[model samples]
Target: MTELTVKKREAVGKKVKAIRRQEMVPGVLYGQKQKNEPVAVDKSAFEKAFLAAGETGVINLKIEGADKTVPVMIYALDRDPLTDKITHVDFYRVDLSQAVVAEVPLVFIGQSEAVKNEGGILVTSLKSLEMKSLPGNMPKRIEVDIAGLKTFDDVIYISDLTVPKGVEILNEPETAVASVKPPRTEKEIEAAKEGPAEEPAVEEAAVPADEEKNGGQQPAAEGTERPSEEKKADA
Candidate 1:
């Protein structure tokens, strides 16, 4: 990819707010073969370049009076969180001959069969990776294949990636980038929703005699008809 060139700017002061009013952003470019120069880039043009190059995209920044082209990377970006507009930007001067370390995004290609044919979930543990590469050798993104992942035990490691020439991966070999795991089954979901089941106590069902005594059943009717047997014994 080629770098986008911006125009030279001479305006500097608090009144530089006027530059924004004119649809331009004020920034400084420094590093590599160039001195720190006050410059302004077209707001629209910069938006286009930023979209095309993204965060890792490189651009050829040219100033009207500069002696030569200085390849740069978007080092810092300032934007309005509410308006989603660019407020300012910082460009780092880089030497094409030297290697720079930056994080590149990971793009997953192909659906895992484990995720498609079986009930499984694809989990990503890493979103991007750090690499050291010269400005001219930078890659847009790193691609990962997930087609071979067909079971819950399958995992893709960082060491398995095939990096391009001039680029070096900066993470540990054992780091997991993505994995396929069994999804929560219907039974598991019901178990989670039901929480824990309580066991019934067997000892609580026996009723105490004292409580029954207080309930008024009437004692034996008190010897109502035993007089005949006593009279016969007396005769």
Candidate 2:
């Protein structure tokens, strides 16, 4: 459903800077065993279409002077670090008959009874699932229903996803998607605020001076390039 118009780019290196200043986004078309083609596309049009398609959905690329349109997906987007403006794009051409691997985002819908009445919290594990499907059959996003979580022990797993017929999920069926956790008790809250009790400090007994053992003069100073025994031997 998304589409963009792009023209074959002759600019490269520092010359591409001029292209961006002209309000065109320079890009490359690659993938599906085809040679990469340098091109420039309309800035505003490409932004809107890329936003809708993301990296998973397909887009119709209408190149300048080329009679045929190609099915492509936005593979990479280069943006200015400070301004966050679109600088460059990379489009991967898709073979319509072949299957493609893509990450499909999970959209959580509905309310859980545990969260509403029992004061339990919902925790999410996996936010997306990797899938393999034909380009035309690929879903933009998958919806995960959380209405079935009735108690703190209830959880939704990958097997519970409502996937379309042609798509194949690549994760384990037993992988948890979301779960309900029991609410914190008052005792635990108080313990958390008080933290662990500090241990009392122990005072160490002072060692007796070596002069007390030597019976007269103070012992040689510590680490003066000569040990006390060696100093006594030298004396």
Q: How far is 97's C-alpha from truth in model 1 (Å)?
A: 0.8
Q: lDDT tens digits, residues 99-195, model 1?
A: 9988889999999999998968899999999989997777878999998787888889998889888788888989999999888989989999999
Candidate 2 residue-wise lDDT, 150-228, digit = tens: 9988989999888899999999999999989988999988999999989999987655687567674556687755356
* Per-model CA lDDT versus the true structure: 0.82, 0.89
Residue 80 shift from truth in candidate 1, angstroms:
1.5
lDDT of 1: 0.82
Instruction: RMSD for all candidates, in order, please.
Output: 9.0, 7.6
TM-scores for candidates 1 onward, in order: 0.74, 0.78
Clash totals in order: 3, 0
Q: Candidate 2, TM-score vs. the true structure?
A: 0.78
Superposed Cα RMSD, model 1: 9.0
Which 10 consecutive residues of model 2 have the lowest summed lDDT? 218-227
Candidate 1 accuracy as TM-score: 0.74
